[model samples]
Target: MARDRKPVKSKGGRPSREQAAEINGRILSAATTLFLKRGVDGTSLEAIAAAAQIGKPTLYARYPDKSALFAAVIRAQVDAAMPPITGVAETATPAARLRQVGRAVIEGAMKPVPLGLMRLYIAEAPRHGALIREVDRLGRQAALEAIAGALAGAGGADAIDRAHVVAAHFLDMVFVPHQMRALLGDVPDEADPLHPTLDARIETAIAAFKTMHLLPAE
Candidate 1:
């Protein structure tokens, strides 16, 4: 009887690419909900799997562990929230493109999910130095390059310093201040960080660039 035992077959249907993507999406949504509700340290893999309605084995099959899963969630959050600036080069003028990029940056910063992830990352930065560095290298540095390229296009080959300045100012004006506020829980739910009033900040940045002759007068 033991010798006649049949080979066990794999259970369930094979997951198609679409199905896998759907599962990944569910996992991310569940992880995001838990991360926001309980903070990174407070949340657990079991909870995520439960929230996603998937078994622990399935969750681990998709993501090896919590750190990998957290990184995936952060990467997804950043990618979805931040629109790539590649197309900005197509604009007729540098100032126009810069302004567009600036607006995009502001909008991305103010988005709720990205803001939450940003807060989470900052909170975890001290203990999770490697993860923080990975995020900066993967997300922030890449975005900075795009901004620098746009600035270079606007300011010309001679304006490298100006480009860097503009890039730094752009980040500070749009993200840093609001991010700090988010970290402090000072941002009201209904407050719009991308409101027209925020245009003053953009205008000030533009003016600073203009003072250095990096941009033409509007």
Candidate 2:
């Protein structure tokens, strides 16, 4: 018979706040890696716990189920990829701000890590429609709010509905085509690579948005 194993005692008091934060970070880091590799549905809490070097009870303490854990991961990824916009001066040119915000959005979304997260999110979307919808809602709200503000300023006397329409057009010009190309795969070697460099794409998108919305309206 195997020798009787000694029982491990809990640390008695709960982990210190700092220690708990570190553990949570560890969990998120592990989950990000696995989710990137295997996608949301493919990954399990047991795998996440193993990857984080934590026990099942510990993982359960923080995240009771896969959707809860995934929601946490998705929120983190969404925030990281498309962080909330703040601090533009009230009088700043809306077009200039649109360029700035548009670039940030594209760059964040196109990074290798976030790009992988997006693919994973799409892969898991068929099953988790509501979860994906929530993420989309958050992203759209941030993007549209800023873009619409910019358009509102640019439009001056333009109606709010028209300003919003123009804002949607701006996003379509800047984000849709390039994002779709990237998501689909790669362009032909002979073809332009979706705007040469990231900054160029951003600049071109801003120019396109202006041509489509501003100059035409003038």
Give the number of the best model, judged by lDDT.
1
Q: Against the true structure, candidate 1 has what lDDT?
A: 0.72
Q: Give the number of the best model, judged by TM-score.
A: 1
Model 1: how far residue 36 lies from native, Å: 0.6
Alpha carbon lDDT of residue 199, candidate 2?
Answer: 57
lDDT of 1 by residue, 1-218 (tens): 01111223335646666667777898899999899889989999888988887778778888998889988998787677767676765545667777787777667767777777887888888877897778766766656666767767755567766666677777776556655665576643435544324566677677877877767776
Write one digit per residue (lDDT tens) for candidate 2, span 20-90.
77778878999999989887768888888888878877888999998888889888877777755666555
Which regions of candidate 1 are displaced past 4 Å?
1-13, 84-92, 146-165, 185-197
Q: Which stretches of candidate 2 lie over 4 Å from their true place?
A: 1-12, 83-93, 148-166, 187-218
How far off is residue 162 in model 2, in Å? 7.0
Native-to-model Cα distance after best TM-score fit, residue 33 in candidate 2, in Å = 0.6
